[model samples]
Target: MKVIIIEDERPAYEKLVHFLKRYSDQTEVIGAAQSVQEAVDVLQQKGQQADLLLMDIQLADGLSFAALDQVPLKKPVIFITAYNQYALEAFRANGIDYLLKPLTYDAFSSSIDKLKQLSGTFSDPLQSIQDIYKKLSKPQYKERFLVKIGDHIHSVPTEQIQLFFAEGRNTYLVNGAGRRMITDYKLETIEEMISPEQFFRVNRSYIMSLTGIKDVLVYSNSRLKINPSFDFKEEIIVSREKVAPFKEWFGGGI
Candidate 1:
């Protein structure tokens, strides 16, 4: 089987090449590349003459999926990626064979066997990677919300948000900047989307931006009340269970 490898890291690339050499006498390395640009150039020159592609998900210029988008090649690709929970979902969703990084011989052989099994099967390659990118890049902070008004969409920056409050079954974005928006996401979902370093879930009903914090006051039963930049009808409170985590986040683990 003649194969082309598209990977950016030199050491990892060289190591995989060495491992493939030892894996089988039937497999021949026709060419190798260190970036999506170089890989595309190689594929353009070689065409269907290359039998398979050993690809990496992230490349120097952008995503390796960008290469597949531009190229018309139909070779089966056995992907390599460092294990990340989010990326793993994409790999599984697309019916692609992937080997997690620090590639071992057993894992490499299994992935290749899977690739060889599906060598001629047709598949859609671009959608899964694009989907994951879209999911991760949304909702910069719990404060900033994605607002859609008719055909227009805007990212309301977190600094302008006064507070997030859970009312009934809905979460509302109230802005000190003088606007209010209703979001169809749960408070927990927003917490996961926002950067942990900049935002904290102070209570079941609220997530506050560090920059918006005005002061912290001790309250009964080891609870703490927070006065945030944008005032609210109810005092913002943190539970005792969450206090240690909150301190560690702000104090750098002292």
Candidate 2:
């Protein structure tokens, strides 16, 4: 299928392409647009050529809905976004199925298969796309993880997790007991699995739980430091760029 992608993030765009290729050779990305304005331009010009559109909710200039507002799109759109409850709910009410970021093949394929299945009989498939996503919009954040421990497997609840950390390509889940266990998922992917209300990605290496934060201190360089319940044994510095948002999160979101 000839598709157009409207996304601002390069990594996310690449992931979508990667998963599409992994799913089938029949998929082709005809054009890519970074902002809502650019997406409108591309869609207006290449509107006839595209069979599908995979759109992102947040764009460089504004929301993807702005582009859709100006353009009358007949092609099937598979929405892409970082996990936002409100955004997902909006798509569930108005558009088609949306794929959460750090895109996986299973979700990608399922979205495609459903589109294919609904292609016939429904003269206006996009009209009913909201019903599909609305049905799927219930809170489905990860509750527990099944991990292999030598020859045995264990289920760890979200409540028991203190943080998820990555070191040299290895990801580990540190429990409330301060025990670190290897996990199959990367910190970036794990960030999407857990509720943002309970966990916050402090930096590239750490996704920490609110309850785990024991205290905060000003670091030598003026960056904030978090002392967690379980010993990380690593400096949990809140990066300079994230300080404002971190403060907001620490103080409870606005």
| Cα error of candidate 2 at position 169, Å | 23
lDDT of 1 by residue, 222-243 (tens): 8888877665667788888888
Best candidate, TM-score-wise? 2
Look at candidate 1 and give me any clashing residue pairs: none
Error of 1 at 81 (Å): 1.4
Name the lDDT value of residue 67 in candidate 2: 85
> Count of backbone clashes for each model?
0, 0
Over 60-90, each residue of candidate 2 has an lDDT whose tens digit, in order, gives 7888878877887656677877755544444
Question: What lDDT score is found at residue 115 in candidate 2?
Answer: 73
Deviation from native of the Cα of residue 148 in model 2, angstroms: 11
lDDT, residue 60, candidate 1:
85
Q: Which runs of model 2 end up more than 4 angstroms from their true locations? A: 85-94, 120-136, 145-154, 157-254
Local distance difference test, per candidate?
A: 0.71, 0.80
Positional deviation of residue 52's Cα in model 1 after best superposition, in angstroms? 1.4
TM-scores, all candidates, are 0.48, 0.55
